[model samples]
Target: MKKIAIFAKVHDPRCLGVAEELVTWLEARGLEPVVEAHLARHLKFEPGTEPERIPDSADLVVVLGGDGTLISVARLIGERQVPILGVNLGSLGFLTEITLDEMYPALERCIAGNFQVSERMMLKTEVTREGEVISSHQVLNDVVINKGALARIIDLETSVDDYHLTTFKADGLIISSPTGSTGYSLAAAGPIVHPALDCLVITPICPHTLTNRPVVVDAGARISIILRSMNEDVFLTLDGQVGMELKAGDRIMIRRAEHRTRLVISQSKDYFEVLRTKLKWGER
Candidate 1:
């Protein structure tokens, strides 16, 4: 609680300003502030810390950007179980819940351990060829398998555990955690799931078949997707941030990761409020 890690999007003027103010406020309160290397250059203070040195070395992380920046920090500190407090600077940030006005209050509660923690489920995805692992990645949002621009429809043969699900003739497939149900999955006609739900959502994007609908599965089940078409070029995207190209005959296995992301939350805020505000639900 005496030392904190601060991460922000240096590209955003709002984030950079708030980050400097936060460092000054923390230092005045006799608390140590650690900022990322790139962010430090834009900061009023001298550059000293790096992303690799934060979270593990500090008690908590204060994210001063939109949900995208927070998600990146979540992935980095997720393994250490360090709590992250996000300050929203982007439009429609479903993950960044705290506002600029609420920053000090949230930080006060966090340092005093007077806050709640939401454990969001993460996905552990592995791409393998001939049973040998080719690439491995973790995602906080959703794992998307889609075709490249100007490419033809890709064939994805999806299966749940031992049961053969179906062959999807579509643009792509999205496997999302309950926390991510409102993201790409929702745009693909997937249902919105509460973060407390311990389930996985399977949504097919632009499916050729009308009967192919979004399906929810137990988090414990593993999903295997085999690339069936050879001519078309497809790729795998993680959290919409990282992507990898896939060739025919590649197998992608997705399941709930053993490690979970711990997000710091204020007790007063509710999930439905966020839904209403972000989605403009029930608004005239």
Candidate 2:
């Protein structure tokens, strides 16, 4: 890809220096580097492209930060199908598996058109209030419906393909894609599903019923949940980034989205290798 877009966590002090070097490196190779507006401003560079407009012109996107940063970019580039290279500046990350030391080499491979990409499924979430659609979002990771700290255990009436399931009495509920199995869902005792799998995971956060367990379903299944807890502080979060407060009668619809996020695989390591390293597996 000739047009490379750079997205960085501008809040980090190290990002400025690394972005400067990256820009110079790309220029020396006769490649065009497009910087996100916020990062470009931090670097004190002239006019930069806005985040929304980057997908229209960029052939590839390179995100420099933790998994959170990469996840936000994935949402921003909805339906574009552009490949993303995630470089972690700090500790190991599930999504940003590529380390800072391996960044340049990975870019070289991408520039040479010799790279592999993993197609990760996304989720489409809609909120319906009083028979009218209020808001909709596309998320690469999990969708969380949670109760406020002061609120008592909330009830979530869940279903699959219009079939009534159980009404979950818990602190919250998480609906995640296979790609997001390692995220919040995993923390709530959800399964660690392989990214290649086409499935959805439903995990309850601190359920009232001890037997309540996480459920895995086909990706094609349409899951629905309604908030049954009245006059309580309930919220719906998308990828742990953005969200909205939920009402008593709010209905949530979640399903696999038509678009998927394409992540460039790190040539230096495989998925199991990442898992072992990140989770400290097999370590005494």
Best by TM-score: 2
Model 1 steric clash pairs: none
- Over 1-284, each residue of candidate 1 has an lDDT whose tens digit, in order, gives 98888999899888898888889999999999888888888875676587777767888888988888987887778578788888888888788888888889999998898888888999999999888999998888899999999889889999999799999999999999988898899999899999888888999999988899999999999999999989888999998888899989999999999988888875667889999989998989
The positional error of residue 45 in candidate 1, measured at the CA in angstroms, is 3.2
Write down the TM-score for model 1: 0.97
- Candidate 2's C-alpha runs over 4 A off are none
- How far out, in Å, is residue 61 in model 1? 0.7
TM for candidate 2 is 0.98
Error of 1 at 234 (Å): 0.5
Error of 1 at 21 (Å): 0.4
Candidate 2 residue-wise lDDT, 19-53, digit = tens: 88999999999999999999999998767899999
